[model samples]
Target: MIDVYLLSGFLGSGKTSLLSHIIEQFKKEGTKPAVIMNELGKLPFDSRAVEADVPLKEMLEGCICCTGSEKMEAQLQMLLEGESFDVLLIETTGAAHPVEAMDAVYSPLFASKLNMKGIITVADCKRWLDRDKMTPQTRMLFLEQIRHAHLIVANKIDLLTDSEIATVTMQLQALNAKAPIIQTSNSKLPLNIMKKIEATFHEKEINETAIGKQLFLSSRLHTFQEPVNQEDFECWLKELPDTVYRMKGYVPLVGHKNPLLFQYAYGMVQWLPEMIKMPPQIVIIGDQVDRIDVLGRISND
Candidate 1:
């Protein structure tokens, strides 16, 4: 399986800058890394962010968790099936929730296609403190991104002082105690720290993931289970709120021997015949999603 890393942060949090450093470090080590950038608007900002020579793909015209989720799956498949690489990195939009965007990889279409590493969220130590004053939507989205990530990269520390940096670290630590937080300036960090990241799905924490937190797994687990009503499943998916940026799951249909596949783009729903060997598990990564209720509905349906 391929190792996929999701990079997210608020506006000007220096996600692209940090990602650029990662790619450069890999090149220095003679490793090739593939990158995917999600453009929420028509302009491809991330495409121009890189200075080094590297193979990259950009998904434009939508947020990775919003309009371009399907395209994300397609682009990722193309890279793994058509191209060759050692690692997969995704740089999410400043406005999009990173967790929801990362959830796009949860399909059976990508189960064997690639392996996902922990999420990397870059927090601008200086900007994060005043985020509440800049805008509420951004504040909410940034908080959501921080909650779901397995690694918190407290970047842009150059602009902050000793006390300010300490405050931000304490706040993030209070919010999430499990994930380790790293300090960086313009993405300048040790490669060994990132290489140490395990690319496996940890179900206990993932199943308990909040809708806003992006899903970061630590293992590869697949299963098969009983049938569910296709109609109710669709309804449930459609009823989800806009904050639900991404949702993915595997379910057996009533009549077919194959599993009835499920993947959602926030409120958008899609189902198809899945021949892959997958379990009854579904992973929902988005903004403000009800994990237990969603799991219960899938099981009852």
Candidate 2:
């Protein structure tokens, strides 16, 4: 079992700095930690912040709540199959909601492989009290991140006075009564607080329909002697319902005999020719279709 920690904060709230420190600390101790950096757009700037030598997977082009869970699930599954790692760190998009991202991890596939290592919310103390200055959407996103956290880093304390820190910490407590607040300058959170902490989350039951509406993955258990058509595959993808957010797997059409490697993020798709005689195994998860109803059909066909 791996300890998966979700590191969440508003944009530019020093999430990268804190996570970088965590990564570097582990590296010094001769340990490797896997990170899943969730980005809001196609530009994967956040993933570039860490050392490429360490394994860091980037999930870009969709929000964890609505458009990216299927890809996220597939990526996590692939990682679980690899060399054992000490921990999993997920850095959510600043515009994303933490609860929805956490809820998405509770799927049957990841049920036992991962355990919650607590959610950490990093707050910019200087901007913490300026609720009126933020846009409605930004404000909602910030509060939601704080509300679901088990540990909060009231960060950037150097920019604030004692009174300011006290006020902001109180506000955070009011929003998240359960989370322990830590005052920090540059996200100097104590590592001990995060280690072995049991998370307490009173979340709403996630309906599978919501899952279907987001993940578009569907796979079959058939041996295709013939390859699939590139143009026809593209056409089928284009005609799929808008809910199908990401759709690319080891499926081959009629022309190319090899596995037609594909990857779709948001609406952008890429096809790469491959050498591995991969089984025609495909997995699509997003708000695309009823997962069991849709995925099970693939095995039947």
Candidate 3:
């Protein structure tokens, strides 16, 4: 059985850094590990930062817990058929629900071949303490990520004092009393923690109840045939409908010789200097997003 490890955490919570360290450890032991990185947007930044020598898979434009679950299963099937690896590491998007992602792994297609080792959640101490600053929906997602973790890594402890760390630990314990919490800096935890016996994947009644009440999240990929007006695009993005939670893609700006990578989340837009020659396409994810309205606003026409 191919051992599967699901790493869940919020955006900027140090999931990527922890994943890199895990990959290195596996390599040092002479075991090949496959990586699957999920992103809310189509433009994948973290996947590229992982070690190039290791096999990697990108699940983009949606979270595996909801919209990307089917695609995730299909990708896993492909990977199992095409490659030979000792373990599979799935790094879910910050917005993902671990229950949903774990449910996907227990599907009949992978029931026999894949063994879920456990869910390791990495949380930034400061971020966890400041979750009230986020929107209700965003905050719910953040909390839910920790709800089902087998182990909780309270990372960035160096950012807190003894008193603050105590408070953070208490908060995490309140949220999840069962999972053992490991306080660490730089997202590092004892290697033995990862080697623990695989957690039992019980088919809880709540899983069935939640399946019907799952949120509606969909993605739309918009392709631009001509270069887009940078200034106009910025204005449009700033005024995007609240339904659009995340937007990212490659865009050929009017003046730029190469296409630029654009990322938008929680009302913030960032244009990375990284350039690519691929066709201009942007993926937008949200609930009930109107593609026609999005096309009208984003198109330079």
Instruction: Report the C-alpha lDDT of model 1 over 245-273, residue by residue, as the tens digit.
Output: 44445667666676656654424466767
In angstroms, the error of model 2 at 3 is: 0.5
Q: Which tens-of-lDDT digit does each residue in 206-281 have in candidate 2?
A: 2232122422332222334445566655655665553443444567756566786666533456677778766664
* True-structure RMSD, every candidate: 16.0, 13.0, 4.9
TM-score of each: 0.65, 0.66, 0.71
Clashes of 2: 19
Q: Say what the RMSD of model 3 is.
A: 4.9
**Candidate 1: global Cα-lDDT?**
0.66
Candidate 3 yields a Cα-based lDDT of 0.76
Better of 1 and 2 by lDDT: 2
Instruction: Give the lDDT of residue 224 in candidate 1.
Output: 37
